[model samples]
Target: MMLIDTSVLISMFRDQTGRVAERLSALVGDGDLYLTRFTQMELLQGCRDEAEWLRLDSYLEGQTYIEATDLTWAEAARIYFDLRRKGLRVRSVIDCYIAQLALENQMTLIHNDRDFEVIAKLRRYRQTTLDTVRSTDFHENDQDAIL
Candidate 1:
């Protein structure tokens, strides 16, 4: 399973070379793709207007949705505390939640944000950046090496 993060979605919209589309296409039509509610909030918050929000919201409605429970929140806090103990800090609290949520659910997080890099280092959750995806032929079997 894979959790699609907001950064990658933005990359898909802003990149003109079609590399993002090519890589993401490799995962489409599979039943394994997913996104978190936190991601949905982040995406919706970035919309320019209600129309855009409605369009994006409708599109997101078709995705596999992952809901975070109270356990997810607790574990996210614990992960942040542990990272702080190690002198590492993820800039986004929501990124921390997303990472821990993915870990809790056994999902590999596909993201473009540097925040995930920081989160992954401290937690060992699977993740690959948009930069990595854009530069390679992404395959399910070779996921570990994609980033």
Candidate 2:
């Protein structure tokens, strides 16, 4: 399964004709796309008005959602401290929580942000960046590379 990060989702919502959106469209049909509660909150927070909020809220309802539990929170703290101790602190604590949530659920994170690069080094979760998707030739059988 794949966890669609806030960055990628924002791009998809803002630009339906963009590469990020195209990639998501190709992968979404597989029924493996997902979102974390943190991601949902981040997306909702981006809304400029009540109408945008309602539109986003309604769209998000179709996605598979995962909520963090106490265990998830505890582990996120550990990850935060560990990364800090290693001098690899992520830019956002919420990002740390999102990473932990994805790790706990064993989902590959799909994002357009570099913050996940640090988290990827410290965890076992997989991450597919927007650049990676764009560089990959999805036209041939190599489509599996993105899939």
Candidate 3:
């Protein structure tokens, strides 16, 4: 039903206050939670050690993983071009790819990145607000913050 973005996952694990955990628990009970291969790549790139890698991998293994077909990959580029034509941009191409995945699949994205917000505005897509725990992960500015 929803794709958990890497930014939100980072926040969930780093948040000492437990708010992200509470939200994640609710999502887990609400049908299926999903991850894109792109999100997996981004997350794995952040792991500091084999221990951290295994821990995160073990948790991610429980979620449903989604992949892009050739057509979908091309579609992602179109979305990028659409944004560029409009004089808009997100932080990364992967955000565009991830947005395309969620948009096509009709899955809401649980994210803590403003890139998703920008992508959402380009074409309607379901999104929820979340934060990167404290100040260390994502910017705290109201405009840049995401869910």
Per-candidate TM vs. native? 0.82, 0.81, 0.84
Q: After superposition, how far is residue 50 of candidate 2 from its true place, in Å?
A: 1.9
> Tens-digit lDDT track for model 3 on 33-143?
888877676666677777878887887787789788787888888888899999998767788888888888998888888888888778788887665333346532212
Off by over 4 Å in 3: 132-136, 139-147
For model 3, what is the error of residue 142's alpha carbon versus the real structure, in angstroms, after optimal superposition? 20
- Where's the lowest-lDDT run of ten residues in candidate 2? 138-147
Point to the candidate with the largest TM-score: 3
Worst 10 residues of 3 by lDDT: 138-147
Superposed by TM-score, candidate 1 places the C-alpha of residue 46 at a distance from the truth, in angstroms, of 1.1
| C-alpha lDDT values of all predictions | 0.74, 0.71, 0.74
| Model 1 lDDT tens row, 30-52 | 64888888767777767777787
* Total backbone collisions for each predicted model: 0, 0, 3
Model 2, span 1-147: residue lDDT tens: 888877776555555347767777676667587788776767776666778778878888888888888898888888888889899967777778888888888888787777788887887787777654443222111112111
